[model samples]
Target: MLWAHGSRVSRLPKDRCSGITPPDKMPTRAPWQALSVVLILLWGHPRATLACPHPCACYVPSEVHCTFRSLASVPAGISKHVERINLGFNSIQALSETSFAGLTKLELLMIHGNDIPSIPDGALRDLTSLQVFKFSYNKLRVITGQTLQGLWNLMRLHVDHNKIEFIHPQAFSGLTSLRLVHLEGNMLQQLHPATFSTFSFLDYFRLSTVRHLYLAENRMRTLPAGMLQNMPLLENLYLHGNPWSCDCEMRWFLEWDAKSKGKNSQCDSWMPSPYRSGNIPFSSMPVLLCLGSA
Candidate 1:
């Protein structure tokens, strides 16, 4: 007689073995085998887990923790009821259209702390409900018009600390809801003139704002004198800690900035401003754009 413990015993007397016919005669399951089969069906499979809960899974119901997981690639779909998905601290290199296949209801997706060099085309095409998109601390060096397509509802974007060198002029055309952008630390050496030509609702005023406008740590040695003609609403300009070559090229900034101002034409000209005091003009304190004394 075969028992469920992986062992078998000899048949007993006829009284005990009454039901024991040939091995293939009856349905062939012993009493223990019947119980074993029932137990197998009762218990589910083993517990296997992905790095985090799918956005459609348990995350939408509440705040989910997907931090510090070493996931190299993304799995398939998420749960239909999930909402906030945090997938930070991974080695994710690229973003494909197939990565996030079914997260339609996802709102906040924290994809910071990864190795993403650049976002691919249509990476986030159908996620209609995405709100806050975070992609900080990566190796991203470029931004294209197609880098951000389907995130029509995105509000706050944090791509501050990265290796971004420049943004395609049309990159911000489709992002209508962008209020404040943080691009403090980057490799942005310069900006393109056609930058805001396609700005959907973005203010057309500050032309420098398109350069991530960080002049404090400017890598550019000189400012194109006449480039400021197109921008008018510039309130604050930081040109500190930069190597500036005082010459006629920057003279355009003086001439064009004066012409761009449609209001109060007498306050001060970009040429006679205080930014030029210590750098070039030592006689006065009018914010003049000049060569740094030090």
Candidate 2:
């Protein structure tokens, strides 16, 4: 008889004389041998419980943490059932379309703090169920129209702290559900009028659902007229930390700001010092003392 310890089987009994079978009468194999073979085969089969990839830890059933792993690319064998994946603080340089091909149930993807320079078209199209995507602190230089396609359900996006210099007019085409966007700390100098506008039948009244927009810490000197017209639902707009020039080109914004502040007095508190200067013409302010000129 064999003794059992937890899930392991102990050694066989030392008594060899008891219940011994004659050599001529013994069967070719023990009766339990076939049963053991079946058990081994079943245990070796791939299943959900054994799907976690190497070096990454799955502390919960639906979340996978691969942060700080020094990974060069997305790891293979990620379970399709996983809902959240944290790939932050890795050395990943690029993402292929197949990186997350079958992960349709994925909702949150954190790939911040990497060296990715650009996202290929359709690379993230498979993430239809994704709600939150964090790609900040990367090396992206531009956002193309197809870079963010098929993310119909995405709500919040963090693309701040990159080197983005331009964004295609249709880059945000299908992101109708977006609520917040971060574009701060980049190299942007200008923006197209339709950069944030979605296609609408009323040509002059295109709109976006975004409530909070972060455009601080960039190189923009003046905003084009009607840029903010597309963001009717905007609640908070961060424009600090840019080299804003108080010139005739910004007259429309000053008028809009005054009108908006007249209706919503509380919004004045969110304005930078130069914008909050009451009853003073923006051009009268010394060019050297303009807000964000530092």
Candidate 3:
């Protein structure tokens, strides 16, 4: 009788089969819940690459049009493959660093008519392949160093038709691969010498190729000295339409004009009259010697 009772006890239910619960023990089936929490955290990063559907413009599949939207801040839901962005005709007043964090493959950013009062430093640090940047026709009073830090593959930059009064020193310090710069129709009071300094890769660029610079039709009295220093064989210079300040301070421009053989700049009918020599337009000379500052 004892042996039969012992065998019955051994055949009884195991812990899993038993529905009975021990009050002292906690539940153990919560591993899957913990794994779900980890997944949620991983996909929530702002810089993570995503795929968003394209709108009307066919040229840029990953591109988003925030135009005429009066968007005061950066747009969200950008895909990873976005190469060109057109935020023109918007009212974007400000931008942050990670505003473009989701677009790792971005190449061009166009912000033509926005009243962007300021662009924070390192605004484009990660965008190395950016080719053309346009900020034409806006209310830009000043450009800060924080605005331009890491745009290594930048080829063309246009900042024309605006209220740009000054360009901060070291503002264009890290822009080494820049080929063309357009600064026309602005409210510039003073020009800086470091405005057009090139730092790397000078040989592959053709002498006929454009390190082309356009400083035309604005409030420039005279260009800062040695502004074009160390620049080798620059092509297509257009500095006409400015009120040339013909003075002793404007003599260096004359010297550079003589050495350039008329390709580095175009100054015609600038000085009043060289024969009389009071304050002729600097354009008249092979290097025009204007009498007073513009």
Q: Estimate each model's TM-score.
A: 0.56, 0.74, 0.68
Global lDDT of each model?
0.58, 0.80, 0.67
Candidate 1 versus the native: TM-score? 0.56
Candidate 2, pairs of clashing residues: none
lDDT tens digits by residue: candidate 3, 39-101 = 787678533444443332434465666667677776766776678888898778888878777
Q: Tell me, by TM-score, which candidate is best.
A: 2
Candidate 1 residue-wise lDDT, 1-294, digit = tens: 443434756555567666667756766458889899877865543222223354323432444556766767664444444467777888878777777756677688888899999888777776668778888888888888777778777666677678887788777566555444555466666666544332334555433233223334435555543344433334434455444444444555445445542333221213334343334431222233234431
Query: In model 2, which range of ten residues has the least summed lDDT?
Result: 261-270
Runs with alpha carbons beyond 4 Å of true place in candidate 3: 1-60, 200-210, 263-294
Which has the higher lDDT value, candidate number 1 or candidate number 3? 3
Who is ahead in TM-score, 2 or 3? 2
What is the lDDT ranking, best to worst?
2, 3, 1
Q: Supply every candidate's count of residue pairs whose N, Cα or C atoms clash at under 3 angstroms.
A: 18, 0, 16
TM-score result, candidate 2:
0.74
Q: Give the range where candidate 3 is weakest over 10 consecutive residues by summed lDDT.
A: 200-209
